[model samples]
Target chain A: MNHKTASNLALAAAFAGLLSGTTARLNAQPVSGHEAGVSGAAIAAGVAMTAQDDQKLPKHSCKGKNDCKGQGGGKNAGKNSCKGKGDCATDGSKPKN
Target chain B: MTLLELQRRMEQDVRRPLTAELTMQPRTTEGESMDEIAAAYIRPNSELTSFERLEIYNRQYWFRVIGAVSEDYPALQALLGDERFDALVLAYLKQRPSTSWTLRDLSAHLPQFLEQHAEFASEQHRLAVDIARLEWAYVEAFDGAEIEPLASDELAKLGPESTLALQPHLRLLAVDYPVDEFVLAVKKPEEKAVTSGAAQLRQANVTTTLPAMAPEQRYLAVHRYDDVVYYRTLEESEFRLLKALQERKTIAEAVEIIAGEEQVATIQQTFALSSELGWFCHPTI
Candidate 1:
């Protein structure tokens, strides 16, 4: 085989080996008959999405005062929202008479 | 003078940088005496002179802007002690004054500022820059923007010619320091102490020396999920792939760029994980 065709075949073989179970997983899904002509890359993408759907990505939430102002899930998110706290000037005071 | 001219001059006075003691400078940039300038615009009251009244506005201007910047980058403050941090912020503000109505934009230029002024960060310069970038990413992810993610079934449509776009809020950063953990460490705080007040909390959190870390390369994805910003570590291959995709490269082109750079197994895993995270969307035409 020529260099280009040989490399392409090797790449396809590698992908076939890597996506073996992935294609199986995709196949196990209820086929709506539309998946018949799906390419291996498409099958791999589908498997990845299905796996992600099954297992949610781990997330890290802001801690303590680091939580953002709006969107009230944090301990000090709402009402206290960390604004107008005299943290800045304009301490909400009137000048003495 | 016209109201617009008067207002412009007043704003110029208010936005000028303060002295070492946090007081207004004695003279303007044009070498004019500040007291003389203030007299022309402001009326002296019983308690204070025109210059002193203008100083109040000037100092308060510094206070509000510095406080806003401090709020956004407490990690940077913790990295460089309070005094140096304040000076750095002061110097930065002097050059890039707040032009946006929102305080959020105050520190937008901070990362670039640190890159140019490595002296501010000293030996920890690179780490400081990385932390600044990561912290700014957090600020952006806080409320930057969000678009509907690509649906699962749409994965079937991905092909060699497909050009996938990442979420607008997703930020990719490659740094020479593991600033992701460092920022988290700096921010993990005594919230109970804040019960006293923000100022008191600020006082208590000052001089908090975190454990030192060795320099290490890190790839990060700063993204928002459900309104909470997060830092997700990415493998080198994954980072490169996402970066290529971000540049509007086709999936086949992206794979070709990274295929031989790493083992095929690594590429396969990276592809799977990135796909699972729903980081892709149809390219907006």
Candidate 2:
């Protein structure tokens, strides 16, 4: 067979092997790192040093209009600071505080 | 002025860029003095001048928006440092104001914004853009829609012509740097007492020296499993196959696309892992 034909045959064999599910043993090897390229030990060390458990779910927030109510602190506490100051000229609501 | 006109005018005044000192600019976009603009509409109380009253809103507006953007792009903030990141965000917000009610959509255009305005990222331009993209993917994966995955029986029914859909929340990214690890490291929950609200923004700005990362093509799948967002690295062939499947290509077509590039064993592993992970779903008719 020519080089091109040989290459095509090899590819076909690869596909056939994949379709037959013969590679489960290889895939069964545990993947602990976020990236497959990185080793599990390295990932473990990185996680241990800095991050929370990688498998644990993160805190998910619901973003609604009132969701930012208590967030009016720190440097961005603009809305809260100006709330009773009658700073909003167009809203027509007078200072209530 | 009509209420509508007054609302528009007030919005225009409030949304104007803050000065370098983080206070309201003295002049409006039309070159009108802010004092003159404020005097035209506001009724000053005994304690404050009309201009000061207006300045409060302007400063507050800028601070709130700046804080919101900072919260979403902490990794980018670390990459570019505080001063430049603030300038970049201010520039971005000016060109593309938040159209949505929620701040969740605030940084949606940030990745593209960084691509067009590379100077804001300083010398780490490419890495900054990659980090922004990765961070945005985290945002999406955190809240993106979840659909029922196709069952194993459904997989058997999928032929060369039968197309499959990947989960909507699965974000396939090709970045020029390995930003996944860096972002995870930066966003790692603080080991100490957890704080919330705008205070979190102040605490979020702890600066770290940007690590030098070599430029290499990295493929990532930013996905949410259970309720948590996770990043997975993919080999080139696996990436290609997933991308092809995402494009609604038939199983055969996707397989054909990646067959030459990957080993038989690797391909088999990819399929098995993908199926087990429920990456594939039936396309909506």
Candidate 3:
């Protein structure tokens, strides 16, 4: 095969392998965690696994008495007070409001 | 005609435009009724008529198309609600139809459709458009074509004359609203539970609502890495620089396209960050 055809075949093989692996993993595990209405831990784990490193943007939190109102200036501002940058001192931690 | 001809005719008849009448009811086809078409081609079993058998395939086709679009645009559905979203999908399909073999192309015209239609062009028109764009970006990022990303060594060899190529799966979007967050919120299981059923009713009753979204200009890069899709917010300058690069501009030309030395610095930082994030592919020398 030509180089392009060989590359295409390799990609197809890799994709097939990924799908089979994912299917096997799903079959072996129970639908626990989020689907079972457990905690958000399962979802968090899944996100961590899939999300790229260095692209984990920091989460913002409400500071002092602001209640996150000054953050995004939305009606549901406080809801995601933990969203945005530089507001939270640490990544993934809730800010003191 | 041969059996192949008959099968083809039956498939064509079933794939016709869905009418408001009953599913199994025969409708007109060209000059002939559906029953006449079916009678001429399809062989019916003892339990059901030829038209009834054909209707089953008809409903399945429509449902599958609708389901694929819905799966791809859950956030859009949540924003427009079930009834309106269903109407929008049906209307969209009626106009465009799925010409591609894959169901993924079903919503390719949706953003443009929403743009042209005045019904969705109300006060929430911008929001609707932003949601559609974001959803489509996510869909494209999810299963878009993949390429072997450029390594740090490969990226470092690039000079002003070198042309940098972005990964095929990367999609750059300039949206008026922060629809990326909204898309993520709607997709999360916890957020779904909070916004659904009794909680939704109670929240609706109370003046306190889900976080409000004030319109703001936003630039986003939606891409897939490690088999998962991600939305990375970008600065306006960075977005412009990347756009220029993607358009086949050389590194020096891309830098010249951006205004001021500060912007050039920002572009450098963004380039470094993007490189680390595997946003680029082999550079064209």
Candidate 4:
């Protein structure tokens, strides 16, 4: 896998772990009478399920799609379309002309 | 017509069309014919009609605004694709017209706007909102006012009763998606060597489908150091404590609010790290 894909997977795993841990901790805590008997683990699991759904985003192709024109379809798609435009750089720093 | 009146007319004309197609039949206030307004205000050049001349400004204005917004929120653009993003920008511009002198402030309400209008979010509604929030936070950290950060010694002098204020440039975000990583991935260095036609075609075919980020609640601190914006991930307790402190709670009070006896060591570590990172301004004793 490429670095980007690997990093994304790592982040997803980390987030899953975080949610699981937080949910378990919250679940272990005593619930007051006024508080609803909501399971934090269940909530976290639901969120984890959503994250898993995200991982299932089908590989988008520009073929036969009208809206993809000049977007992910063209030769300049993911390239630095912001060349010479100082404020457009992703690093939040002004690009040197 | 007076210069101010002319200026107003031009401004109105410039912001008329959300897209180039609308330039041909641009809308005007009070049901005034666009052609008539253009004819009255704009002088036709050798190569263009009065309306065409005015259309140039109209198209340019939209292009510049859209371009700036697209640059600021590239991940959002990628997620929504060009068409939906265009629609969102046009709608957002109409709802929240540019009131600030700087174009940087144009996207300030985008997150809230996305929240209210779920149609624009597509299926990735939550992802879009998180990305928008992250992008806006980055923008704020980049250009927000910079207050003098408290020195280590100054932070050390603060008693438990002292209320510490965070630096003006600091922004706290509670996000569900790991958007920071996604942003970094999107901003990864583009291959500059794809000059040949065949290679360029291959590059174009590469899918823009971003990997699905797992939904995890994250406490993020976006801050600037040496004029460059950076993201710092914070623990939940640390986030809560900092948030309380930001709300003007005294250190003791903030600690009590979020940190338990078991979390005291972790909170102390976070406090030291925050101080070292210059996350605070001068404390109000």
Candidate 5:
């Protein structure tokens, strides 16, 4: 699953050579043993995660219909999920199909 | 109590009805709500319908949290079926309160949650946990933090005599099932396995059928690559060495521990693969 390309191979070797950079890492908190700053990562990652989830929404059914002719729902259903068409109730529970 | 105390209680009560699961516990700030609570905000304006304003936060809040969590653990939901997944997620919301401000933070503990919960066992809930863990790590790697990582200078600083510390953000996981494989199977562009159920048959292997290694220990290391969280597995020796390092073992001691094992070309290959995948930060510098 992880065979590297020619470019990635070079990157790997370069990373290997960069071991000198991490010396400060060893110095930062050798005694405590836990890496700090996880909360920052959590929040940053969370924003991206949530944004990605939002983009993946499933399409709603009531996009079409000229007159709101079908079963439109009541006030509680809101404009987003409810069409408020004929035979439509307040809750928007029934599927038009 | 004082007016402030009473004000907080009323706010909690008002917020309670906004939740999709109204039965879910309220976030009573600072302490318990007083017998007589004060209103934090004026009652919904009679001019503008109360339901309109309230629905904005109520539905959006519920959908936002649920949607965010759904992405992190899609495979788990796929395994559980829509109805069961929704029910469990609702229960999950109540039992485990959100401590982290973001929904992704809420996912960090979901795997552990499903494993311990009795309601989920029939699905071989362990499998669900594995899927969730992998999904969570993938999300973490997709957009997490990054450090330049350790450099050769840092590795040299150890001097072969000193103990080395492992980064905290790096996580090591040992799982049983081939969850990554399963996840891959679902993500294939041609067919959407997540929607279509029926567990795909896997190649029969010693690990799958044999009782000795029934619960195969799949070693995984999770760390950030540049700006994202990425992970790869290590071999027996590599895992032990990292474990030793995480435990603050000296280089000489950790190497000594590994030297006891059979050193073959494959082991070195394993280390190379792991190191390439950001398993180990640059040595020390």
Candidate 6:
């Protein structure tokens, strides 16, 4: 075998020789298969927002509170969700002075 | 509030603001509930004295760490764009809110989180998950443990059916994008070429109108070797091999399985490659 091939073989032998049961137990945790938990798009957007800020460039908003009020706020409304005790809480009660 | 209620409320107060999806934290301009909570928990450590400035510090703390995570997973940022990524991170903050005092704990479930994303079938998504996994592993490898190197004779003493154990800080991941390429981009930003066959194939659609990838995901292996964090690509066979080993299969069994479909030469090659990575487990008392 050539150098790369020899090295590859050595690595394989080493793998073959390495211990396993305890390792298996340690790695037994399963990856959850849920959609909301992992989204590449969500992760990417975070980076873009930061990079844009680092450049101090003009930007649009979506799902955020800062300058993104118009461009970004689709369903998100800054620090508080639109559900209870927040922006949505303005409906029922009346207070007269 | 009852003690239980007070505890619950305090915990909620600490956690809710930390996970809020907004760019800036909610504050008390004059007299707001959040501001009151902030006044209670936060003590300003910066030069700014105004309560407003103090609140700003509280908000900045979370954003800073999140931004660091964004730095750690730029490919993810690229895939989600600026707005959505922040939103997703905010969502992540809400559900699996941080409990640690350090920012590094922020990435603990990133790979698993990405695994659960509905739209994360894209190569970028896969790359993001994988790089996140590697980055976290690297952190753990550096901070979590100190151990002896593999001794060649260690496995010889084991019975044919005995199971070996992997190191505590090591992690193996399967991802969608060529995460190595994504991390490489982060490391050099400008100099490196994207070389993985998977990455090239996924990118091929950019020049044309065609959409790339039926599923656009990739697989990965992340681990620690002699205190250095290392990431490597895994073929289907290789991943299964690792999986089997992870499932407590003996080395001979794992080799037999890997060698079943693959050529003896390739299996031998793979075994050698995995060995150097210290993919073997070491059992202890």
The candidate that achieves the highest DockQ relative to the unseen native structure: 2
Q: Local error of candidate 6 at B231, Å?
A: 2.6
Reference-based lDDT, residue B104, model 1: 72
DockQ of 5: 0.05
2 versus 3: better TM-score goes to: 2
- List each candidate's DockQ score: 0.06, 0.14, 0.02, 0.02, 0.05, 0.05
Candidate 1, DockQ score (0 to 1): 0.06
| Per-residue lDDT of A94 in model 3 | 32
lDDT (Cα atoms) of all candidates against the true structure: 0.66, 0.68, 0.61, 0.63, 0.48, 0.48
Off by over 4 Å in 5: A1-97, B1-56, B166-169, B187-216, B223-233, B264-285
Candidates in order: C-alpha RMSD to true structure: 10.0, 7.8, 18.5, 16.2, 13.6, 15.3
| CAPRI level of candidate 6 | incorrect
**lDDT per residue, candidate 5, A1-97, as tens digits?**
1323433343333234324223333343324666655442233222222222233443222222222322112333322444433223313234557
Q: Write the per-residue lDDT of candidate 1 for residues B35-77, one digit (tens) a residue.
A: 8999998888765678877776676666667767777787889
Per-residue lDDT of A40-93 in model 1, one digit per residue for the tens?
433333211112221243322222233333322111222234333322222223
List the candidate 6 regions with Cα displacement exceeding 4 Å: A1-97, B1-54, B119-146, B192-219
Please report the interface RMSD of model 5 to 1 decimal: 12.0
Candidate 4: list runs displaced more than 4 Å: A1-97, B19-29, B189-209, B283-285
- Lowest lDDT 10-mer window, candidate 1 chain B? B200-209
Return whichever of 4 and 5 wins on TM-score: 4
CAPRI quality of model 3: incorrect
What TM-score would chain B of candidate 5 score versus the native chain B?
0.68
Scored against the native two-chain complex, candidate 6 gets a DockQ of 0.05
Docking class of 5: incorrect
Give the runs in model 3 whose Cα sits over 4 Å from its true position.
A1-97, B21-25, B29-31, B191-211, B283-285
The best-first sequence of candidates by DockQ reads 2, 1, 5, 6, 4, 3
Off by over 4 Å in 1: A1-97, B190-209, B260-265
